[model samples]
Each structure stands twice: as C-alpha cells, then as structure tokens.
Target: MMGRTVLVTGGSSGIGRAVAARFAADGADVVITGRRVDTVAPAAEALGVRGLACDATSPGQVAALAGELGGSLDVLVNAAGGLPAAPAAGTPPLEALAQEWLSSVSGNVLTAVLTTTAVRDRLAPGGAVISVGSIGAERRGGSYGAAKAALAAWNVSLAAALGPQDVTCNVISSGYVAGTGFFGDGMTEERHRALVEETLLKRPGTPDDIAQTILFLASPGARHITGQTIHVNGGAFTTR
Candidate 1:
C-alpha cells in the first residue's frame, strides 16, 4: 500500500477507523472522512492520516471532498453508515416509521452510491472500492438490513462497470462486531450473548477482523476477485 492514496468514509471510529489505521500502517497516504470535524480530526491524528469532514450521502459534500483529493485514488472504502437513529418527537406513528425506513436507506445505501459516483472517474487503475455491509442483509434484517442488501446489489453493477478499467468493487458483509458504538445503548447482555452464540466462533467480532479483510481486498493478491460480497461473520450466515 506504500505510496497509494486511500480514502475511508465514516472513519471517525469503529470499523472505519480500524481500516484506515491498517492502510496507514502499510505506508499508504490515507484520508478519513466523517460528519463531525472534532471526531474526524482526532481519529486521523491518532492514525497518522488526514481527516476531512464530509457527509457521504450529500452530493455537495462528496463533490467537495473529491475536489480536495485532486488526484487519482488507489482505494475507496465506503464505510460511512450505520443503524438509523430513532425518529424525533412526532405527531404521527406512520410518518415516524416512514422516516426510519428512509433514514436507513439514505444512510447505508445512498452514502455508498453518492460517494462512489462522485469519485468514479478519479479511481486509478488497479484500484479497489470496498463497501461495508451487514449480515442482517441475509436474515430478518429490517430496514437497515434491506439497505445493506441494496448495497451488495449495487456493488455487482459497479464491479462490472469498473471491470474494464481494472478497478475491483466488492462488499464486506460484517457480522456481530464488538468494541464499536454501533448498538448504542440498546444492546442488552442477553442480546449480546445470543448474537455471539449464533456465530460458529462463539464470540463477537473485533474491528480488526473486518479491517484485515479490507487490507487483503485492496492488495495485489485479490486483484482477480471482484463483484462479490465476502462475508466476515464468523460463519453466522454461510452462503453456497
């Protein structure tokens, strides 16, 4: 990864942060983006990478970020998404439900879509575009799961479009990962245990687990692999 330019969205913390750190350690010129300047700056400093505040879901922000890069990108990691926050105080139940669904789709799906579109032309040959997905896409995933499923679907077409350019596009469908604020205050002990038991490894995944996979997918060894969703869920959801 030495001399390569990498961009990771939603890299203020958690899986995104881990991925950025791994690339930076490999001597890549890495830049991380987040919605908040305070968080992004601190995380970038800690990882020895540059930080930019840009909302991936917004075309304006994404365009500005691309302008800032000003050159070809060797890698683009679309890690800028999560479970949607609760709807604000509302007068109607149906509207709140609709908002939740929309939030999920915009946050998870649109973020990847807009960001990738903004920088598609700037992706260098041999580049890799990796998006973070979720196991929820396979099972009883609600709105969030549905959005992740869309992400994987989008990746297939993207891979084909970029294939002729020697740019690989893929998704990393992550499982139950610990040490991240993904669950917020909603994760109960029982829920945590149940999720762990569901995995063949019988333990929650770490950020490094997903980070290491990103490293490989961006490497020369994975040059031939593209347009596939690699599950990193500890056998929680296996595919034929």
Candidate 2:
C-alpha cells in the first residue's frame, strides 16, 4: 500500500482503527472516517493520517468526503457495522422484530452501499474495496447476522461491476476477534473460553489478523481475487 491513499470507514475504533494503522505503517496515505469528530481527529493525528467526519449511512456525507479528497480514492474499506443497542419495540406482535431487522440492515448493509455508491466513480483504477464481515452471519443469531449475510451477497455484484477496472471487491469473514465491541461491554472469561474452544487454533482472533488479510487483498498479490468471501476464522468453518 505504499504511496496509496486508503480510506477506512469507522476508523475511530476497533477493526477499522487497526486497518488504518496497518496501512499507515505500510506507508500508505491513510484517511479514516467516523461520526465522532473528536475521536477521529485525534486518532488520525496520532497515527500520522488524515481524518474525515462522515457517517457511512449518509450519502451526502460520503459524497462530501470524497470531494474533500479531490475525488481520487484508491482503497475503500467498509468497516462500519454493528447491531443496535436496543431493539425497536412496537404495538404489533412482530413489530419489534421487524424494527430490529431494519436497524441491522441500515447499519450493516445500507451503510456500505451508500459509501460505495458515492465513491464508486472516483475510485482509482486497480482500487480495492474491502468490507469487514463476521462469522455471526453463519452462526445462529439475530438480525445482525442477517445483515452481514446481505453485505456478503452485495459485494458479489460490486466485484463484478468493478472487475473491468481492475478494482477487486471482497469481504473478510472474521471470527472471534478479541478486543472489539462485538461482545458489547466486554468478553467474560467463560465466553472467551467457549469461543476459543470452538476454534481450531484454540485462540481468539485479533484486529491485526483481519488487517493483514485486508492488506493482502489490496495488494498486487491478490489482483486476480475478486467477488469472494475469504474466511479468516482459524478453521472455525471451512468449505469443501
């Protein structure tokens, strides 16, 4: 990623922050975006990168961000996604479930769609689009998993559209990445043990694990790789 300008959404924290740092360490001109202006600016400055305050779910904000960068983007990492704090409740029997599902869709799927659409035209030739996915989508869970499944499906079309431009699009389906907000408050000892037990490596993943994969996907080494979901789950699940 040397000399490349990479943009990581939701870079204020978690996997996004790690991705931004990895690219910056590789000498890329890194730019990170988050809804929190204060958090993003300081983190970017500390990491010797630029910061932009843009909500990935908002098309206008994403467009303005692209304009600020002079409309030339080399890499776009869609890492902004999570479940809502509380499910939306309603009078109808299934209204809460419906609202919760919508919230997940808005957060995980729509956010990536809006950001990708706004910058698709400005993406440089040979650009790469990497979205952070979750193993939750494959596990028994709620709307969050469903949304991630949608994201993976959407990336397929994106890859096809950008293939001719030499822009590869892919998703990294991560698993048990520790030190993230996926556990909400935090991971307890028992929960951590269970997660590790389920993995072949008998350990939890880290942000750097996903970051390294993103770096590979963005590099010339992975030029031929596109329209695929690469699992980074330590053999938690495998395809025949």
Q: Model-by-model lDDT, in order?
A: 0.95, 0.88
lDDT of 1 by residue, 7-82 (tens): 9999989999999989999999999999999999999899999999998878999999999998899999999999
Per-candidate TM-scores read 0.98, 0.94
The lDDT of model 1 is: 0.95
Tell me which residue pairs clash in candidate 2.
Answer: none
Which candidate gets the maximum lDDT versus the true structure? 1
TM-score, structure 1 vs. true: 0.98
Give the clashing residue pairs of candidate 1, or none. none
lDDT by residue (tens digit), candidate 2, 67-125: 88775889999999887556534457587777778888988999899988888888899
